[model samples]
Target chain A: MSLLEFLDYSGVAVFAATGALAASRKELDLIGFLFLAAVTGIGGGTLRDLILGQAPVFWVMRPTYVVVCVAMGVLVFFTAHLFESRYRLLVWLDAIGLSAYCVMGAAKGLAATASPTVAIVTGTMTAAFGGILRDILANEPSVLLRPEIYVTAALSGAALFTLSSEMGAPLWLASLAGAILAFGVRGGALAFGWTFPPYKARPGRHPDDVM
Target chain B: MSLLEFLDYSGVAVFAATGALAASRKELDLIGFLFLAAVTGIGGGTLRDLILGQAPVFWVMRPTYVVVCVAMGVLVFFTAHLFESRYRLLVWLDAIGLSAYCVMGAAKGLAATASPTVAIVTGTMTAAFGGILRDILANEPSVLLRPEIYVTAALSGAALFTLSSEMGAPLWLASLAGAILAFGVRGGALAFGWTFPPYKARPGRHPDDVM
Candidate 1:
């Protein structure tokens, strides 16, 4: 529980930073920057809770997550230049955030008394959804249908986490292993240009063929 | 059933047109335009279906909706100028579309095994979510959470439709009444500056206020 809490706060801080970085590119106001940060920081968990039919949502219930985001927002508002150089650092931090949230989401699902498969899928969704939403809000493409291996890495980590838990592993070990695996897979994908292939269908009279 | 089909198709076309207007403003490519149109036309339905746990979603089950979005995309591609003035036209067309879809969604929910309350909420949600998605995609503020009475109008229409149906009213009469009610309410709000008051929570200090 201690580790989970630490990771949740840390993940939120990193996501908030990246979100601030992303928003800076849009040249929006301070409110927009903070809104982006808040959305990216807790967006995944909120979506997961909503889909699970949970009430109040995590951020709404605890409300600390919003504070964390706002704090980061204030920091970014003043120190935005700290993030201007070397976008590579942002990517690594994002991967770490994703890994943390992946394990957290799985743990949340398990706590919710869902089945293993449901837990695994839910965890992956929790990890991936924040970035997807961030991309959408940033006016970039939604990452859901993108070719990237983002979802796959989260899925891999979540599967391993669920499997370990089913095999009687300790909760702490399960979470640690899942986070490491997710971080590694996403890191590898970033380094190696790994991606899912394009979706295919019958290639006939559709005008969409020209695209 | 025929009325349902008509409203459903009309909603698709009008929403697609609205999406095209958004995309044209951004000078999006064909892919982006088509994607935006699809999201605008079917986004509300997709959200409603997912929340209701409806499987295989309407577009996934029937490719025709995708085709319709693509076809509209092509039309917009060739004649973007014809829609140069569409935003003005769309204000009313969208109100009509909202009216049509609220009743459609309510009817679908009422027919399904869901509770009446859920049905009522789902119907309003179904009518409102498309524009919500469109604004999100267009990187504009969400109309749903705005001071505008967008969601309230949809709720009124949905209630009217559901109640009329339960009273054994004919489908046309119920749909017409619901449509007019929704349209009028939304129109009135637009004309008269109606708005939802902000949440009543006391204002807070900066950074601390977010929580």
Candidate 2:
């Protein structure tokens, strides 16, 4: 398989594992694990394809991706308890998936739209939206609302990839650099609890008064 | 406009109003209200189109649907506080949208897929998924998890429409009957607190043991 294809499959598997772990925490049944895993594995790409007008979507074109997700869900279901810190493992696995998806999504976006701004936005959405769906379905607090820098890493990675490609970098080099930068930023957040400042509402500003 | 077309637009507007009210409850800014309104208005149709392989999606093709949603957001932003019970209004508006979407979604699905089962599923999703997305984005407990018969109402409406059409009923008659059934079921739930029995897990059945 090509490097990009390999990354795509691995990213789907890793994200599915994280989803299964989430299901385990919720004490859901096997069906729940499979459902969550499948959704988290492919939700981002599905949304991206819909927005970009890619008919049949990625998984509908290649059902192997769903098989891979189901396999990860089954694997995680039996073995989740063996891990001492499943949450930590889920976070790290998600980081890996995020990095890969950002570059791949950006590459696909650039190819389809030929617009760097759209590519960056699609890339970020591809990386982060699956996790958002996972959290929402599992009734967990959204990763988007967390203090740590999650989406920022995906956005930056996508931006970097778009910039590098625009600057005439080789495809492989751009992909590698983008993935590494994303993983590094997310790693820093996990290791050091790095975060952006939370938004503080102005006390006197009312909703009705704003518009 | 045709009756179906009119219902579709009304559904979008009503759904958007509910979404704007959700944003109001969260005390979000104008942008947040618009974003939530747009998403809640079109999310279900977007998903249905993607699954049915309809390229460009409904809103992208019309664009007027999005304009309707934005108008609702702006109107609700300024006028939301005037309602004595915003939640009750939101629920009633949502019920109206749900009933319309179920029939519309079923019709579209049957036209696209030529399968009654697919039509029913798509109809239910079109009716309910937008509200699910709204609640998730607004951090409200999902209507799906509520004891009330929400999805069941959508599902029955879709099924009824598909069945009536298959039985040689006129399009308008089938549509009206299906919509009224959905609304009646939902209204019964709201007025009488009707609910399906909750799922009960069997004791000693473990996830690992299931498969």
Candidate 3:
């Protein structure tokens, strides 16, 4: 397989594992694990394809993606007891997936001749949307609501990739730069528990009181 | 406009209103109301179009849907306090939207020459996905997990529509039957608090304890 394709599959596998871990945490049934993993692995790509009007969403075109998710879910279900720190494992795996998926999404957008802004947005969405769906399915507040610098990292990677490609960088060079930048930011956050400032509450202020 | 076109627009308006109400309950700002409303209004149709490989998503192709959502958001933001029971309003509006969207989705699927089963599934998705998404964004537990017999109502309507179409029923007649069936079931659930049996607990039996 080409390097990009390899990276894509790796990202899918890691994301699926994280989703399965979430299902285990929720004490959901086996079907829940498989469903969550499958959606978490491909939800972002599916949304991006739909927005770009790409027919036959990527997973539908290649059922191997679903197979991978199912395998990951079953594997995680059996081996979860072996992992001492499931939360940490989920976070690290998510970081890896985020970086790779951002690059892939940007590449796909560029391949489709999307504008730079649209391409970057596509990349960010591809990286973050699966996790969002996973959290929703599990009835947890999404990481997006945690004041984390998560989507920002995906945005940076996507923007870098789109900009590099626009400036005539080779595909491999551009992807490498994007993935490294994304991983660096995400990995730093995971290592340091970094987060952005939460929204300040205005005491006794109603949202509609002013308007 | 045709009756179907009218019903589609009405459904969009009601769904958007319901979303806005949810934002109001969450005490979100104006932008939040608009965003949630737009998503709830188009989420179902977008999913249906994507799965069916219909390009440009319905709302993207016709900006009027978005305009309607925005208007509904602003209106609700201003008038939400006037409603004494916002939750009731949301449920009633959702039921109305569900019935209309199901018939519309089934028609769209049949127009695409999809199999009867696929058409029925599409219809159910189109009727239910928006509410699922809205609940997620609002951080409310989805009604789908409430054992409310919600999806079953949507499925019955879609199945009825597709079957009638296959039996040479006219468009208007088939759609009417489908809409009435969906609305009747959903409305009855609302009026009588009907629900399905929740999964019984298997005491002390772990999901992962087995193979």
Predicted model with the maximum DockQ = 3
**Model 1, B69-140: lDDT tens per residue?**
768766776665543354555566667778878887887888775466876898898898888777776675
Best by lDDT: 2
Clashing pairs in 3: none
Model 1: clashing residue pairs? none
Record all residue pairs in model 2 with backbone atoms less than 3 Å apart, i.e. clashing: none
Query: Model 1 chain A: which ten-residue window has the lowest total lDDT?
Result: A202-211
- Give the TM-scores of the predictions, in the order they appear: 0.57, 0.60, 0.60
> Which lDDT tens digits does candidate 3 get at residues A138-198?
7766878765579988999999989998999988888889999999998888777778776
| Two-chain DockQ for each candidate model | 0.05, 0.11, 0.13
Please give the distance, in angstroms, between residue B171's alpha carbon in candidate 1 and its true position after superposition.
13
**Candidate ranking (lDDT, best to worst):** 2, 3, 1
Model 2, A1-211: lDDT tens digits are 8777877898788989989989999999999999999999998888888777985799999999999999999999999999999999999999999998998889888887677866776787689888888998999987755667787788789989999999999988888899999999999999999875432223544433310
Q: By the TM-score metric, which is better: model 1 or model 2?
A: 2
lDDT accuracy of residue A28 in candidate 2: 97
**Of the native A-B interface contacts, what share survives in model 2?**
0.14
Model 3 spans > 4 angstroms off: A195-211, B1-45, B55-128, B137-139, B144-211
Estimate the lDDT of model 3: 0.82
